[model samples]
Target: MVFAHAPVAIAPLALISLGGLFWLWQKAETPFQSMQIGLGFGLGYFGTGVSWLISSIYLYAEMNLVLSVLAVLCFILFLTLYFILAGWLVARLKTAQRQGFNWVVVMPAVWVFAEWVRATLFGGFPFLMTGNTHLMTWLDGYAPVFGVLGVSWAVAITAGILLWLVQSRAWVGASLVLAVLWLTGASLKNVEWVTPKEKPVEVALLQGNVPQDDKWLSKEFLPTLKRYVGLTKQNLDADIVVWPETAVPAYYDVVERGALRSFIRDAQLLNTDILLGVITRDDSHRDYYNAIVNAHNPEQQYQKKHLVPFSEFFPFSSVLQPLSELFNIPFSEFTPGADDQAPMTLGGHPVGLSVCYEMAFGEELIDSARQADFLITVSNDAWFAHTLEPAQQVQDVQMRALELGREIARSTNTGYTIIVGTNGQLKAEIPPYETGVLRGEVQPYEGETPFVQWRQWPILILLLGVMLLLVWLKLQARPSRKTTAED
Candidate 1:
């Protein structure tokens, strides 16, 4: 499972690794033993997969070395609990007579639910979703139809088949099922869901590559602001110019209004719309926001709605206050943007918007993407500190692009700034940790993919329904109670 994501990215490893766990669940003599298997698998999987968290805690959050390790381990252990419970759930199917149904349907369904619960719990750590492994593979075709969870379903089902192949006598049936899945997935690859509009918007994404440590420094503030503005100034000829999240490095009001507006006015005069990130405070100053500023149209800005749990806001505020004191995290009080906030129009094109890690939630962006021509995600991932997190984030953006079948303009501080086409293909990008501008043309797509149209409702409903049906079958097969009882 750890090998499913960067920096390994071998697609087959996702299902193969999961198959091993399914095998263990089959072999366990008791539910507790299955739970033990889950515990061990969870420890190995999330321990290595989420090691980046320690860097975010120790280096960026500036927590003590010992505390950072403790915090990350605690968090990983919490995530592991989900799988531990899932293991117990899978073991419940062990006694069912329809062993084939148990493997083919119930096990994969449980795994899908586990993935969703893991992603949604505690503001979601959506790292290393099993579906994210099939970026360029045939299974990625499922992404457009069912979203990442659907892709996860395809992967999970295959693992179940592998489990059945090893343990059951249904060899030919399993082989045929496997063939149909892959062949159908490959055929779906040729399916086109979105109609691309004729005009392509040339976008200039600016990566200032500012060090996270120096980003808040008073000495570096002015230089960083000037550096981003200078980069934008050099790209005035593009249809749209963008900078990464909080590229302003100050409150929205802190920048000399005249100077900043003057630059925007100059760019507007040349028909360019500049979209950049800055922290902004609402009128009463009681509410602060991590927002995108539409330099050409100040009032038409997008604040981030999906706040990352720990960094942007505490999961349980009253309870986590003490933990905050120890962590000393920044941006802990940001107010989320409105759920129905309007998408911005840049370069005369409707654009879906996300700031920082908001790209992790595909459903949240669907509202913006439904009526938009393309998507934009501005992030500052410098805290990742040369880890695989940035690459993993790029994959998230790619999956979103595929899900919506719309091109994405992703600008980030320090690296992995990229242009993802509607098919989840990397069209263009600049090297991470380098100060540069990635100039590319993204063609605007004008239609909705099925995943965007229905979201995850169909898939979620189907999985839960199957699980309930299996429970009903189990109950029907239960031994009847004897009434010789009158005693």
Candidate 2:
């Protein structure tokens, strides 16, 4: 899992790791032992895979080393519980009469279902989902139709089949099954689900390279504003010029009272749209929003709906105020935007916009993305500077692009400023942690991938339907026993 997730990003490692873990689960004498093995696997998997979490907590959250390490351990343990659950389930099933069927079919089902649960429950953490590891693999074609979870299903099933082959040596049957699964995806890769617009839109994605700790400092605010303004002016030739999340480092009113109008007018004069991120206030409602707005048309905006946990909003704030102060987190109370809000129109094209962590939640982006010609995610990843988190985030962005079959423009404050093509390939990129503009052409796509139309329902229904059918079959196979009360 660690090798497959990021920085390393080796796809086959995930398969080998999952298969080996499954083998251990089957080898365990009892489900309880299987769960213990799974707990260890989880510790290794997430402890290394998401090691970047320690960087974020230690740096931005301002937590002490002991507390940060403990906090991260708790998070890893939480993620590991799901793996333990899978292990217990697989162990019990592997002992069933239909051992071959259980290992090949039921195990994958268990793994993917757990993934879906992890992705949905507790506001979702959809990271290192395994499916994204296959982004460049033949199985990537499954994304547009089945979504990331579905692709994960394919990987798990394949891994299970490989495990079966190792034990049974039923080479022909396994080969045939693998051939069908893989070749089908290979064919699907060529099917263009979305058509491009007549004219491609030019985009200039700005990387501000602002230090996270210095972002909100009063002295740095004007310089940050000036940096973005200068960058936008230089890139006004683009159809849309974009700034990273919170590039202004100030509220809407603060910028408006200073340079907002002139900035908008400058873009308007050039017939360009500046899509930039900033904090917006609703004074009457006392609401704060992490938002992206069109400088040329402020009303054209998208407020981020999916907020990062703890930093965005404390899960149980009333009882956690002391914890919040200990961490020194900011923007902990920003209001989430309405789901049905209109997509932001940027550079004469409708855009599905995501901010920072929200890119990991595909459903959060899908509603607007279905109606959008393209997608743009503005993020401030400086909190995770010099870590795999940003590149890992890019992997998630690629998954979204492949799922939706639409080009994605990713703008970030610290690093990983890049454009992902509809095929989930990097079309263009600006070097990480650098101050620069990545100029690229995004072809607006006109149709929806199956995923964009149904979100995660197909995968869920398919998984649920299969398990239900299997349950019915198992019930039918059981012998009937009649019991009578003795007189």
Candidate 3:
């Protein structure tokens, strides 16, 4: 699972790891043993894969070291329950034939279903998904057609095939099948599902290397705002300029009549449009939102629809309020934006805007991107500073661009200010722990990929059909087993 992530993402190894998992499941003699095996593997996989959670909780939540570790463990243990259920289902569904139908069909189907459920339930995590490992591989071509979950289904099916090959020792047939699958993926990479709609627009993405410990300090707030404004001033020639999430540490109302207005006036003088992240509030309603606003027109804003759990809003605040107070968490409550909010317009082009963790939900972004010419996602990843979380986040953004067939401008606090092309390739990026402006031109794309138009329905339907077929086969075999017992 560690290797399945960035910096060492060996794509093929994901197949091997999952195949080994299925092979181990085949050895379990009882349902209890099967669930145990699944839970153990899941614990190890997620425990290492998402270990960065510990750093985020400790740094942002201000928890003690031991409590942070426990928090991470508890989260992983909850996620592992999905795998345990998958194991129990597989054990119930597997027929007497250990190596043929169950290994190649039922097991893979159950695994993919389990992954989909994990990504759907409880507002979803969707991190460290198996298909993310194939970002650089030819299999990534499948993204536009079937989305990430479809790619995950393909990977799991291939792993099941590998398990069958190992058991049957049919190296030649297995080799042919593997070669055919990869070659097909390679061919699919050449297809273009979306085209450029407008001339390239020059963009400047600002990365403010703000220290997380000092970011929320009262004394440092003005300095941090000045730093971003100064950095943005250096690239006013760009068509659009972006700031990281919550670039203004204070709320919009608090800064609107002061430094923020002056910043907007300066940008307007240069004939540049600026979009910056800030906290927005509805005074009459007493509601707060994590949002982005156009510097020139503060009225034009995009509120983040998908709020991060715990960090943005505590799920069971009534019950966990004491725990939050104990940990000294700031900004522990926020109301989500309306679900059907439209894309914000900037510089005469519709821009799909996502704040921080909102970009993780590809399906939700599809509506935002339907008429958008380009995409912008801003984040303050300083919470997970010095961890792989930010890098993995960049990769996830790249995949979203590929799936939607749109170019992405990702602005972030503390690094990885990037411009990604429609093909999901990095066009330009700033190094981590640096304060700089990544200047680049991104061509606005129109039209949608298949995944964008249909979303997850196609893949979900296919999986459902497979599960129904398995059930039918299981029922058909039941009568035969009874007849043999009577004979």
Please state every model's RMSD to the true fold in angstroms. 2.2, 2.4, 1.8
The TM-score values for the models, in the order shown, are: 0.95, 0.95, 0.96
Residue by residue across 38-87, what tens digits does model 1's lDDT show? 99999999999889998888888889899889888998899999899889
The stretch of ten residues in a row with the least summed lDDT in candidate 1 is 478-487
Compared with the true structure, model 1 gives a TM-score of: 0.95
Q: Judged by lDDT against the true structure, how good is candidate 1?
A: 0.86
Candidate 3 lDDT by residue in tens digits, 302-345: 99889888778888889987777746655668899998888877
Candidate-wise lDDT, in order: 0.86, 0.84, 0.84
Lowest-sum lDDT 10-residue window in model 3: 323-332
Candidate 2 per-residue C-alpha lDDT over 28-93 given as tens digits, one digit per residue, 9 for 90 to 100: 888899889889988998888788888778877778989899889999999999989988776655
Worst 10 residues of 2 by lDDT: 478-487
The parts of candidate 1 lying over 4 Å away from their true place are 96-100, 256-261, 483-487
